[model samples]
Target: MTTSEIWQPPSEFAEQCRELYGLTCPPRWGTPRRPEYPSLGPKAWKVMERLGFPPMPWQRYVLDVALEIDPATGLFAYREVGLSVSRQQGKTQQILGVQVHRAMAWARQNIVYAAQTRGMARQRWEDEFLATLDDSSLAGKYRARKSNGHEAIIWRKTRSKMGITANTEKAGHGPPLDLGVIDEAFAHEDDRLEQAFSPAMLTRPMGQLWWASAGGTDKSAWLNKKRAAGREIVERLWAEGVHPRIAYFEWFAPDDLPRDDPATWRMCLPALGFTVTEATIRAELEKLDPGEFDRAYLNRTRKSTPPQDPNVPVAAWQGLADPVSQAGPELAFAVEVSQDRAWSSIALAAAREDGRVHLELVDRRPGTDWVIPAVVRLRELWDPVAVAVAASGSPSASLIDGLIAAGVTAPEDKERPRRGDLVVMRSGDLVEACGQMADAINQGTAVHRDQAELTAAVSGARTRPSGDAWTLDRRRSLADVGPFYAVTLARWALVSRAEAGRDDYDPLDSVY
Candidate 1:
């Protein structure tokens, strides 16, 4: 039978199967099987049964299509197989069965399993794969080598060995592979594993590579690319009536589907009734964040967009800007550095005569070399009440020693900061600084000169949880947030210095 004829059960029986097992057989999208072509799927299933881990209906469906033998060439139909499914769907067991079958069926075959890291691959091999094989009926047929960095399971009779390694570009250096499996492929950020394995399997006639994972975030570049390619191939198959060299299977709910509905779960989760239940999924739904639940259980990829600060909306922030705003006599300055350390910003804040706070981005330039001299000049000209730098957990913290050596004095006691002291803002201090800046904008108590860098930073700022509060997440934000963060620290330092009542210097004497 051709691909289309291989998996079409009667409509009534298909509906019954859906109701009974919640198995989305044939997957939501995939290369359909050609039953006329011989396959190793049934034999692999038999091996699984002997190992006391029989294939589920969904697993059988995948194996039947992916393991088909090309009658024209007498080798595997596909050179590669890509399987994307929801978590907790017996993927590991299916993979284990395939690896064991390949080892036992073919003498001297080199099979390899890889995870994101060497340590993770070793852990899975020792804890899951080896443990299961040792408890199986064919336990005595294999010898496991447990030595670190050289772990393998060798079938005694066939002399075929299955090894474990990390998903790195150098992973495939040693020998040619008959079978290579990249498990939990979502964690890989790039195509290094594919680059490593593809050439290693080039000369082996029966060699196959497998990529398996649940959905991942937009940052999962390699997996997302594979998923996009698989989807395109499936669409092509529908239009052209021709099969491709890669076998692709995906089981995922549509973006519009209601996540909490059981019908939606049944559509994507092939092992819903077999190994998982609606009640268990409901519990998971309640426990996991909505985005995480969608990615992990519904197999929906997480979409990402340019960062926007929810705390300070763009319209509200724009309303607080004054193009010609001038700083008041009593001033404070703060420095900030970009997460990549490619750029730095300096900002100042002061108390206005009208009881409002004035904020301004003083200077933002490339590299750290210019920051120390610039800060020293600003201190000499303005005689600001205080200068602040985050004490830890920020790229700007690296400038503290340089600032202190440039005659910017650090407070002997942070709890009792004096005027002219370099205030080392701690985690809690940064959190408070962010909150205070937001409040100043919202309460109409702050004004800025509407600098382009400051506006852009405000537009793209994002935050991460810091204890019970939140601080700027410079690393993850879409744009450079150094300018905005510097302004916030300056405002915070001004208010904190005023509270400490330590400004003994007269502002009228300053050059600026």
Candidate 2:
């Protein structure tokens, strides 16, 4: 086929691609609408054929991008490539094809394949890498060495080899690396090992780094950070701008899609029809937790591990539910925002006639932009005793000036004496409020109207240590706990006022 002719997939593979949901990065900053020619796919296909596994269309597309060369420099255009798909989508097969082609066809030297653990690295090398090479047509042409600290394959002619090592800061040293593969990239907590591994590739003219992973914990800070950066680049491309250096591909259902939807399953699992049948996916979904299924099969990063023991027990929180809404005279309000500024909630805690606090979610909305206005509207309606807002460590921190502008401020602020309606919950007070909320739930002193969103937030509330105390851990929770925190702050403000030797204070009457 000529370079000008559009490359067509094999008949079987084309049929499979038609049946699947596939997505790929359009192209690097300034590239053709479609690849003109593939420098790597043909070579990689030969080895896949030898191994009795052919390249899927999606896999072939990845190879074309990974090896796409710059016309002027004759070097790869994208040096860093990220491949994230649901588990069992034949990522290992794709990885194997690339490494083999690099070793045999390109005769590349000093390549390292690292896994999260030594045992995992060894198992992959033994079960897949060595088994493929040993069983292939080129078995007699290569040498496989398995020693205590040394596991590698050597090309007999050029002595070019691929080394297998555990992911460690010390592992990527020694030889100048031509290519690096980080398998299960999501398991890496930080980029320290990657940072150390990268310098070896700096001097190579054709150096490349490929990251492959199934989605991991939401706490995979490093991986999430890179994913965010990759998304920004894609956005820039959509805005008619370009990021020349990086290529990112994700095979996953959109986060908002129904997890059990067949289309969503097919979208994330490119090999659903081939390696895994629809029946198999259904069975897997039935067997796994929703969060686990989201992470493993849907290729989503979620809070996989719920706190060992949450601040509020499910039973305890359920016990506090009063389905019949109650209203009390002395009402206080609190506003809280998610750490990422994605969602915010305002909750009210009213002092009940029975001395217990009755909580209710007043308003919950996306983004911080609506928070100040919502607070102002609630103030006008209820004339709340105080509106507790986080002074630090919250998206609401930015709302302080806005609240003050709307005549809400601290009582001690003489400059804004007419606007002393906002009670700033500092970091120390925030921690105390969280503990207090937990205590009230345990003691059944905090009753709630049993709102679904608030219940979910309460159920997912996990505590994180903050100095001598602990606060709600929003990041590790399954859902946004802003509602939970908002209620807590409101309750604390209401009770704190009553305990401060102000028995005659009727906050509702005073405010109204």
**Highest lDDT against the true fold, candidate:** 1
**Candidate 2: deviation at residue 470, Å?**
17
Question: In candidate 2, which residue ranges exceed 4 Å CA deviation?
Answer: 1-39, 253-258, 302-458, 461-512
TM-score of 2: 0.61
Tens digits of per-residue lDDT, candidate 2, 88-198, equal 878898888788788876665877898888788889988998898787777887788888678888888777888887777887888888888998888889897678678
Error of 1 at 235 (Å): 1.2
Q: Which stretches of candidate 1 lie over 4 Å from their true place?
A: 1-26, 304-306, 309-512
Pairs in clash, predicted candidate 2? none
Q: Estimate each model's TM-score.
A: 0.58, 0.61
- Name the lDDT value of residue 501 in candidate 1: 53
Candidate 1: minimum summed lDDT over ten consecutive residues — where?
1-10
lDDT digits (tens) for residues 229-257 of candidate 1? 99788767766868888999888776546
Candidate 2, lDDT over the whole model: 0.74
